[model samples]
Target: MRIAYLTIDNINDNVILAQTFPLLGRLATLPEVDGIDLFALRKHGGDRYRAYLPPTRIRVRVGNNHGIWHPLTWLHLVRFALQAWARTRAGAVLIGRNPISLLCLSLAASRRGTRLVLDYRGLLSEEYVLQGKIARRGRMHRLLRRLERWAIRRADAILCVSERLRERTVRWQPVAAGKIVVIPCCYDPRVAGRDEATIERLRGELALDPARDFVLAYAGSLSVWNRPEAIREVFHAFRQIHARTRLLLLTGDLEAAQASFGDEAAIIIRSIPHEEIQHHLALADLGLLLRDRSSVNRVASPVKFAEYLACGVPVLVTPGVGDCPDIVRREGVGYLLDADLPLSRIVSEIRANRSDFRARCREVATRYFDGDAYRALYGELVGGKAFRRLPESPSVGKACA
Candidate 1:
């Protein structure tokens, strides 16, 4: 079976390298897949990330000239859809990585008896309101919802990043629920190898003592929903009890992170190359994933959750981030902060129970966020066969196979 996957993202965004490429690489390995055509409708104008594309088994066509608000953006979408539709063979699968992409291809999907798959990552409309891009339930929000609904209704299969997201989508479009499958944002634990020299060097640069200082790390962007202020609050609270505690902010927005935590000498912020993130995360004992409780976050799956666990760094995440809180609680991999748990106590518990955390967190990563299972699911989705869910995961289980 052949496949076409489309997404609208800035070429420079890390998701293209970390998320998209990895996913396509896995799908290309499936025996049932003949080849894949990736359509990247970049929202900006650059080819800085083009060099990172995977091997030729997955052909990439990047459309990198139109901004989201540009008058020609819709026309560009139509033209791109036509190009994708023309390239597809009969019975080929067309997968949209977002709502707008699928909405554009809905008509084309029905033409050649091809399967349409919606890769639902999050609630885009609610996210726009959270980011102040559009008002809640306003004109633009309603329009986006209609488009999403249209796409979801027409999809032959739907892939959700979290169970909560699947549930919410079911409530929104009850008839489409049966086609949706939950597949969280996953990672290959092999990417997070221990490098003692790199860890020591990062410690030296950050002025953190290997024996005395405990590092709390927050990786990824400082998006509005991520609540950088909440991270700062947690860091300060930890420092109040343990003065040697240090905060490391590894983000792409270096200037914004510096502006937020510049006055604190105990805090270190830097924008480093993506390849070096594993070593930097290795330096930390705990990972911070704080986000405000909103509809946007309620059904979201942040890849950092899996990244932290894969690195053997237990998370200190807030409640209501997809299925993360439940996973954290059930798996004993991290602490979920609330009005009940004191900051000092949680830190003390973490420091005392540092041993064996690496093993346990790695186990959780394999059980819940393993990439192999997702690859199996994607294989089945694109293979034009009846969907058969795999058994729940055990140790290296085939939950989606």
Candidate 2:
């Protein structure tokens, strides 16, 4: 069946959506499927706008972006939705993080008898609340939450990035249980394969002492909620334990993080292209996933975790947030430290079992987080009979929560 994937964000620029786009590319390879169309919104010169398909045969459309701050952006988005409805004979429309797109697509799908699939990346309203950008009980927060609930209720299928998020969505809107599906953000090993020379070049350029220093790496947005403070604490602990240890932070906000960390024992590199991530991961000895146990962080499925695993790197994670720790512990891929654990104890664990941890990292990715399994899962969600039935309780929510 023909499917149209819609998102407000530029698909090429969005990290998560870009990773998912390849998965859709794979789905289009299936025998029963006709083709997949990707419609992304792009900003135009001044207020003028237009729509055009991507050069790739995947049938991509770049709809006019009414500058994010423009008062008429929503109206323009509605117009784009109507145009998409008129142009494609899609059986379903998969809507991404854009709520305005969700509302418009839902309406269009209803009119065309096309199914609407809502891919909820995160609880955007809750994220604002945790960031202190919006108060929980504020009128704007309430209004946004109402709209989120409406989208959840209207969706023919709801895909969440993590099980915790699926559970939370249902708790917030009970009717969501009937439609919600958890398709955790994952790593594909194909994405992990990098040229050996490129990998070596990056390691040499970074002056990474792979044989001597134990590289402790963290890659992603160096934002406030990620608890850069805790990461600094871990680096401090790493310094005390091993003289040959160094912390590497790969982020888009390297300049800001360098200012934030001051003279900390960490090397901060500004963001690298997605194609080069495997090389950076290959040069690293260990991975770090540290986030504060805030409401916004609790249900996150940070894409970095999968990237780390794909590179066969061991991870050290903070407990009680995301499924990373559970995946680490259950798969024996890495260590999970309690938030309240003594820094000395954390350091000791890392020093004591470093070898086994690295081996486990490779094993876990092959055995549990296999890319083939992920592909099969996506295929089932899109084509199998189970798509209509509610997923089993254990399969649809957080393991710990």
Q: lDDT for every model?
A: 0.79, 0.66
Regions of model 1 farther than 4 Å from truth: 43-45, 188-190, 393-401
lDDT of 2 at 398: 20
lDDT by residue for model 2 (1-401), tens: 66667777654443534355655656676666677766666663321211112223477666565665466766667776776677555455455454556876664575564667777777777877876767898996897788888888887667777777877888888887766656666665454576889878877877776556777888877666787788878777777777767777777676777776776545545577555677788777778988777777778877778778878787788775666777776676777876575655645665577667656676666554444554544554455335433333233332221
Q: In model 1, where is the ten-residue run with the lowest total lDDT?
A: 392-401
RMSD of each: 2.4, 4.5
Poorest stretch of ten by lDDT in candidate 2: 46-55
lDDT of 1 by residue, 207-326 (tens): 787578888999899988888889988898888888999998899988888788886788888787676788888888899989878888989888889889988889988998888888
lDDT of 2 at 87: 55
